[model samples]
Target: MKNTMAEDKIVADKTIATKVIEKLREDIINNRFETGSRITIKEISERYGVSPMPVREAFRTLEGEHLLEINPYKGATVLRIDEQFVRDVYGVLRALECLLYETALDEIDQGVIQKLRCINEQIRAIVDLPYGAAEYVDLNTKFHSTIMEHSKNQKALEMYTHYHEIISTIRKKYIPVPERIRTGIEQHEKLIEALEKKDVLLVKMAVDEHIKSALENFMTQFSQGK
Candidate 1:
C-alpha cells in the first residue's frame, strides 16, 4: 500500500509539473517574465496552487530549453534571447527537418502528398481571415509533422515536435508580417513540387532552402527590430 501510494504521488507530481511547464514555457516566450527576470520555486508554486516539488521539476525543463538559467543560490532567471539563440534553434531545426524528410521519402505516398496539398490550400485561404496567425501556426505545424511523422526514428521525431513548438510560437508572434508568411508559402509549394517528382536531390534542396529562407527572414526582421 505504501509503495502504491508513493507511485501515485510520483505520477501526480509529474502531471502537475507538465502543466506548470506548459504555462511557464509560454509565459517566458511571450515575455510575461522578461529576460533576466528572477523566479523562485516558492513564488511559482503559490501562483499555480501547486507544491514546490513540481515547480522545481518544471524549472529544470524550462532551463533545458534554454529559456531559463537555474542557479543553486538564486533560483531561476529568464535568459536573453538574441541572434545567437535564434541561430542555434533554427540550426537544429533545419538538420532535424532534413533528416525527417530523408527518412520519410520511402514512406511518401499519395495520401501524404494530398494531405500537404490540402494544408497548403488552408494556408492560402487563412490570409483572408482577420485573425489567423495561431491557426496558421497550426496548419504549418501540421504540414511539417505530416511529413516528419513517417520517420522510424522515434527520438528524432520527439525532438522535432518539441523544437517545432518553439518555432511555432516565434512564427505566431510574427504573423502580422507578410514577408515571412509569403516566403514560407512559396518554399512549401516548392517542396510539394519536389516531393511529387520524387527527385531526391530536388527534395533535399527544397527543404534546405526552405529552412534557410525562414532563418534569413527571421534574422532580417529580428535585426531590424533590434
Candidate 2:
C-alpha cells in the first residue's frame, strides 16, 4: 500500500510539472514573456496554484530547450535571441526542407499542389491585414508541411517537423514586412510553377532561393536590432 501510494504521488508530481512546463512554453511562444525578462518560480507557482517544486522542474526542462537560463544569483531569465542561434536553426531547417523536397518530389500529387496554391492565395489576400504576418507564418508552415509530409524517409520528416516547431517559436515574435511578405508569396508561386513543370533543377533552385531570401531578410532585421 505504501509503495502504491508513493507511486501515485510521483505520478501526480510529474503531471503537475508537465502542465506547468506546457503552459510556460505556450506563454513564451506567444511572447507573453519578453526576451531577457526574468521568470520566477514563486510567481509561476502562485499563478498555477502549485508548489515551487513542479515549477522548478519545469524551469529545468525549459532551460534545456534554450528558452530559459538559470543564474545562481538571478534565478531564471528568458534567453535573448542571438544571430548564431537564428542562423544555425534556420540553416538546418532549410537543409531539411530541401532534402524532403527532393525525396518527395515524385510523391507530390495534384491535390496537394492545389492545396498549396490555395494556401498561397490565402496568404496573398491577407497581405493588407494588420495581423497577416502571423497568419502567413501558419499558412506557410502548412504549405511546406504538405510537401514534406510526402517524404518516405520518416526520420527526415520527423527532423523537419522538429526544426519547424522551433522556427515557429522564433517567428512568434516577428512580424514580416509587407515587402517581405510580397516577395515570399512570389517565391512560393515560383516554386509551385516549377513543380508543375516537373523541372527538378528548377524546383531545387526555387526552394534554395526561397530559404536564402528568408534567411537574408531575417539576418538584416536582426542586425538592425529589430
Candidate 3:
C-alpha cells in the first residue's frame, strides 16, 4: 500500500510538472512573459495556481529546452532570442529539410503529391484572413511533414522533429506577414512541380530558397522589434 501510494504521488507530480511545462512554454513562445525577466517558483505558482514543487520541476525542463536560464541565486529568466538564434535554428532546419526532400521524393506517390497541392491551396486560401495565421502555419507544417514522412532516414526525421519544437513558435510569429504567405505558397507550387518531375536538384533548390525567404522574413521582424 505504501509503494502504491508513492507511485501515485510520483504520477501526480509528473502530471503537474507536464502541465506547468506546457503553460510556460506557450507563454514564453508567445512572448507573453518578458524576455530576460526573472521568474520564481512562488510567483509562477501563484500566477499559474499550481504548487511550487511542480513549478520548480518545470523550470528544469524548460531550461533543458533552452527557453529558460536558471541560476543559483537569480532563479530563472526567459531566454533572450535574437537574429542569430533565428539564423542558427533555421539554418539547421534548411539542411535537414533539403535532405528529407531528396530522400522522400522518389518514394512519394501521386496521392501524397496531390495532398501536398491541397495543403498548399489551403495555405493560400487564407492570405487575407488575419485570424488564419495559426491555421496557415499548421497547414504549412503539415505540407512539409507530409513529404518528409516518406523519407527513409529515420535518424534525420527524429532530429528534424526535435529541432522543429524550437522553430515552430518562431515560425508562427512570421505567418501574419502577407508577403511571406504569398511567396511561400508560390514556392510550394514550384516545389510540387519539381517533385512531380523527380528533379532532385530542383527540389533541393526550392527547399533552400523557401527556407531562405522565411529566414529573411524572420530577420525583418526581429529587426523591427516586433
Which candidate gets the maximum lDDT versus the true structure?
3
lDDT of 3: 0.81
Give the residue spans of candidate 1 off by over 4 A: 1-14, 224-226
Best by TM-score: 1
Over all chains combined, what TM-score does candidate 3 have? 0.76
lDDT (Cα) of model 2 = 0.79
Predicted candidate 2 versus true structure: per-residue lDDT over 1-226, tens digit per residue: 1122222232344588776776676677556678888878987776667799988998998887677999876679987657877788888887887788878888887887899899999999999898888888888888888887888788988877766666666665667888998999999999988877767788889998999999899788767755
Per-residue alpha-carbon lDDT of candidate 1 for residues 1-226, written as tens digits (9 for 90 to 100): 1122222232343578787777677677767677898999987777666789988988998889898999997899899878888888898888888787877888889888999999988888886576666677778878888888888888888898788777666554664455566677888999988887777788889988988887887788777765
Question: lDDT tens string, model 3, 1-226?
Answer: 1122222232344588776776677678777778988888887777777789988998998897778989886789899777777788888889999898899988988998899999998888888787667777788889999999999898999888867877776665554577788899999999999999999999989999999998887788777866
Candidate 3: residue 150 lDDT (0-100) = 94
In model 1, what is the error at residue 16, expressed in angstroms? 1.9
**What's the lDDT of the predicted structure labeled candidate 1?**
0.78
Candidates 1 and 3 compared: the better one by lDDT is 3
Clashes of 2: 0
- Number of residue pairs clashing in candidate 3, backbone atoms closer than 3 angstroms, sequence gap of 3 or more or interchain: 0
* Per-model TM-score on C-alpha atoms: 0.84, 0.70, 0.76
